[model samples]
Target chain A: MGDHLARAEDFENKAEKKLSGWGLFGSKFEDAADLFDKSANSYKLAKSWDKAGSTYIKLANCNLKLESKHEAAQAYVDAAHCYKKTNINESVSCLDNAVNIFCEIGRLSMAARYLKEIAELYESEQNIEQAVVYYEKSADFYENEEVNTSANQCKQKVAQFSAQLEQYQRSIEIYEDIARQSLSNNLLKYGVKGHLLNAGICQLCKDDVIAITNALERYQDLDPTFSGTREYRLLADIAAAIDEEDVGKFTEVIKEFDSMTPLDSWKTTLLLRVKEKLKAKELEEDDLT
Target chain B: MAASDPNKLMAKADKQTRLSLTRWSADWKSATVLYEQAANGFRVAKDYENAKIAYEKASKGQEMLSSPWDAAKHMESAAALAKDLRHWQEVVDFYRRASELYMECGRPQPASDALAKGARALEDSMSEEAIQLYTDACTILEDDGREQMAFDLYRAATNVYIKLEKYTDAASFMLRLGLAADKCNATNSQCKAYLNAIVIYLYAHDFIQAEKCYNDCSQIDAFLRSDQNRCASKLLAAYRDGDVEEIKRIAQSSVISHLDHVIVKLARKLPTGDVSALKAEDEEEALDENDLT
Candidate 1:
């Protein structure tokens, strides 16, 4: 690591000297860019991510000076990758720079990919709101390029995070729409049951039994085969359980489903919340009686 | 075991095992064991065709024994053998069957994964069907509240559509994506989708549709305040006014520049004619002529 660092510093010194003593009509920036590139690689080898990132930035500046927009953008992307281990915010900023340059150069797909990387970084940092923002941007870029599948994936993340934020309505709507779109495609037909189930669950979370019932019915209409699935039965039974104000039945239904197919924590949490609401209602009714 | 040649005997034995399962009194365990042994023998002989058949028989026996997961695994093996033989259709069918078996056992994640794998296997040879599989896989995961896992499936499907130049379908999907994003309260994504749709419309020279998209987006409070909305509205106004320079100016603006590459390219191609206003003028002229008549 020390040996690499020494090499990096030496290269940096040479780049500075070359830049400072620029001869007329010489490709000074190009030569400096090459030196800086080597310096950045050495820094990376030394595991000095911050230094590598900064060196790449310098390289990008040189590339920009030489009117190499694509290389400048690429350098920025490389810089972002290096910064990712050391400073997430810096990495994100570097990526943002790369995305802008990519877009400027009409590399929409590349820009979109970088936008996704930015979203992922924010996601890892637990900055959900920011993550959604970038995911949305990337999804849009992907969509504009006729990359529906990629866009859908990003949209799914946005939906998932929003659901976590208790934006149940929005989450439900997105799932329902994607589900509906999937139905027309033969390969996607099998997934309709799962989508409707998620939408049904989101509906249940609103704590309106009638609305949940209506949504379930709407889902049935939307996907004719959904009524035959285990997911449908589970949602229907839960809705019945909630409507009857039977906390026991609700628990029983969840337990029955859990036995057959384990529910993830997200579902478990949402189901528990529904169960709590049911319990609250049951107690209120008993008091009135 | 080698009375008639082991490979031929194994192939014949798997067929007989499949045929013998007609009666309820037949023992599925013995049949499954025999099929597995035959499949292994065939695989050892490098006879993938017979191995695939034997695995299918084994999968059927497992299904009869009420072990859908094991059945799915056997079916997956059959699918893999079929893939090795380059039987694309059989690979898809086996994967679908395996996925169904997994779904029957209430393991949606694996079920979805199986379909995705099938899609991947078919991607090079049969892109259209691969997209179908991908879409199915994504839908399953999304429905199961595992949308996070289905992300790549969506991306793969989109890439296929773009490769096929199904721009209209892709654009419609983008609109749907926007709506989904809107539901998630992802303001930026929603704005981008709306703007993207408009750009696609403009790219297609559907100026009237672009205007309609702009008007629709302007209704949303978040979009109304978004930079994307600002960029879209400016471009639309420039189109209406037939201000070529203004269109050029907006298209080159930092805001538009930061948009997706496709949108940027489309924006650069926006017609300088009075597309929206000309239609309005023609409509007005028609009304005036009708009144005179």
Candidate 2:
């Protein structure tokens, strides 16, 4: 009985080989279909899932030869699932193939579901970056599916990660430089002011003017509206520090400030400072007389 | 008075008058002979002014006597004397006179000879200042339908243009030279003009036009059996547009046999990739093959 079973298995293998060759070469639709079905059944009964999947793939190819696209796609999906049970790598590859096939067949949502499944798998692996990258790819694919809020959320995640990455990289350099300078100078008023100014610029890069002002006040007082002419105000601040009591010098600073057209609030505050210093100097001279 | 005695006195007076006439004829003949001697002496002494005057008087006297040979000879002598004295203007005048006399005397060869001499003298001593004279001579020759001689003057003018690098003018004259040579059945000179045109176009680097000229030269050389390598070289140089390898192939394969020195210089200046190692590898392979052998 065992010899008879072995003979039966040899006969099935020979029949499968003949069927595969016939499926490749036979031009008639009925013959090709019959051969492919025989090969697929033989592979399935032999417990060779990989070979079974390939036979199903060949069956799908035969369907494509017959221009039976719907049957071909079903056969490909079945083959993909068969490969999935054996290897996750093959499963992802087959899933990608099915997604492409679904996209080609204009079943974009089905294609997107396959992409989401892949992204979720990556996400479960804690490979959020790769998941985000694939999610962005799926969003591009579903850009026409406007009602798909999932794709929109994916796009938003991409933007949020991109901005966060840029901000993180920029903060590293900016904070390190500020910390080093502050330590070495012992945070003197002028040194603290320099650090604050640098920190303000960094905050501005981050679009956080509140943080910029808080940083600035650690060294010196910061005027509101320090957006456009902050550099000019800093120059005036330096001039005031150097010669605090000279009304003529303060008047010159005010004149220099006035010469700039379209002044921002920073320049306005600097002008006011110059005026107050000049007034204080005049009052002191009057007292001396 | 007796009749015989009066007749005798009249005869005697007639005899005396005849003797005086004879003496005067002799004196006139002697003076004519002396003028001939003086003209020949002045000509031999290189005194063209005196020779011209003496020859003029001798010619007149011979004309009065209806001595055509004497008149022709004296006029020819005067022309020769003027030519020998390098008096070109007077030489042309004397030559014209001599030619007219020779033609009148029915010596057409001598007239033709005298005219040719005058034309040659003008050509030899011709200067830029004498352009009008040259033009006049050319006009006369052309009006007489002597285009071959006119082409000589044209060629001379072309030489002036060549001196000035007026290639277009030189080419124009060269074309005229070809036409004149064709008219005169002078194939050799026509071929020379065609060759000259090819050279001009080659110098101008006008290859397309030069190719046409080269074809003409080739056709001429076919019958003349002359080597056209020089012209072919020029054509190659004008038509060549690439590096030395292409030029070398063309020069080697075409009728042109010589390599251009400029091409050689340029090839030397071109950066050659170092291939000695590659060649060494080939040599090693050859050595290995020999060892196996």
Model 1, A116-217: lDDT tens digits are: 999999999999999989999998778645467888888888878887778899889888988966764536766778778777888998998889888988
Candidate maximizing TM-score: 1
Residue A20 local lDDT, model 1 = 96
DockQ of model 1 vs. true complex: 0.01
C-alpha lDDT of all candidate models, in order: 0.80, 0.53
For each model in turn, which proportion of the native inter-chain contacts is also found?
A: 0.00, 0.00
TM-score, model 1 to reference: 0.50
For each candidate, give its TM-score against the true structure. Answer: 0.50, 0.29
Model 1 lDDT per residue over B1-293, tens place:
46324355455545554544465365677767677766756654567798798889889989989999999988987997888899999999999999999999999998998998788778779989998898888778767766546545654565466457675655665665566566667677678778877877776667878888788778889989999998888887776666777777776676764444345555666663446575576678779988954
Q: Per-model TM-score of chain A alone? A: 0.95, 0.42
